[model samples]
Target: MLVITVDLVPSGYEPMRRTIATMSISNISELAEVSDYQIEATETSNPLAGTPPRTVRCLIREHARAQSVWALVARASDEIMKADSAEL
Candidate 1:
């Protein structure tokens, strides 16, 4: 069995964290084809500017039964990376 874990650093705003989590959950649900994925808010810290920063953890299974989950994670990561590159 395998596992995929994604860590998110909130953009100095609680709402951003929630937004990202919601997007992630929806993306996982639609692409992963696994119904057992979970996302959790872990901790928060104050940033120098803007709102406080938050951290989130997403857990996804990567077993044979969850092949789609693995594919979804790969796709999501690819999209994120592409966006980051575009920003650079």
Candidate 2:
């Protein structure tokens, strides 16, 4: 199993929050085929920030040749903050 932590910055916000996720596959050999990933994030509490917390649900398609898990997460984060993407 792999545990991945992703740091996210919501649009129009200063404070940062994180999303943690666990995967069943561990190591490059385990990913011999394309895989689908879903990362769900709930609203976080930011006492210092006046705006409401952001919620996000990211869906990513990871190719078998993907180099690093971090790259996949970065794509997801970019998608999450898009104006028409998964942020709620």
Candidate 3:
């Protein structure tokens, strides 16, 4: 899966990253139980003054599933992190 970060100015990428970091399943799980958990944020860009420059917007999609989407995403993240850490 691929996720893109969008920002008006070039420096906005850090803030965007912070937002995603805060939304991590482990962080939210500390508060409430996130179930059915389908949340996807897509960044789309369209040319404004032509193809040279473009404007971007984030498209968020949230849906319900029989199983907890958060579970799957969280597990995947943990597994990936552990594998990477071991390699380090």
Candidate 4:
């Protein structure tokens, strides 16, 4: 069976990594637990933006499975970081 795991860069934030719930690809509830999980993971594991709440808002504004959503979030964060850096 295929599994979906959160694959964000480790930020020495072990708690967030440990708390991530591994979901099965076949599970329809994958999106359910992703809201808080993603927020915490993004805030702790990979803080690409200055304000974590704002960053999370920009990244995940809709419901999606954790695996897929995280991928998009990572990409968005990278772009946001790049843009922020370019402004300097």
Clashes of 3: 0
| Top candidate (lDDT) | 2
Per-candidate RMSD vs. true structure?
11.0, 7.7, 13.9, 10.6
Q: Top model by TM-score, which number?
A: 2
Of the candidates numbered 1 and 3, which has the greater TM-score value? 1
lDDT computed for candidate 2: 0.50
- Superposed model 1: Cα runs more than 4 Å off: 1-23, 27-67, 84-88
lDDT of 3 by residue, 1-88 (tens): 3233334544666554432121222222222333222223222323462322222222222322244755455554444333312110
lDDT of 1: 0.41
lDDT of 2 by residue, 1-88 (tens): 3445545657836465454322222333345567665555444444666435565655666545445866665665565655242323
Output the TM-score of candidate 4: 0.22
lDDT scores in order: 0.41, 0.50, 0.32, 0.38
User: Going through the candidates in order, what is the number of backbone clashes in each?
Assistant: 0, 0, 0, 0
Per-residue CA lDDT of model 4 for 1-88, tens digit only, reads 2344544435976655553223332223344654322221222232454443222222234434446745654654554444322111
Residue 59 lDDT (model 3): 22
Q: How does residue 59 of candidate 1 score in lDDT?
A: 51
Q: What are the TM-scores, per candidate, against the unseen true structure?
A: 0.27, 0.46, 0.24, 0.22
lDDT of 4 at 33: 54
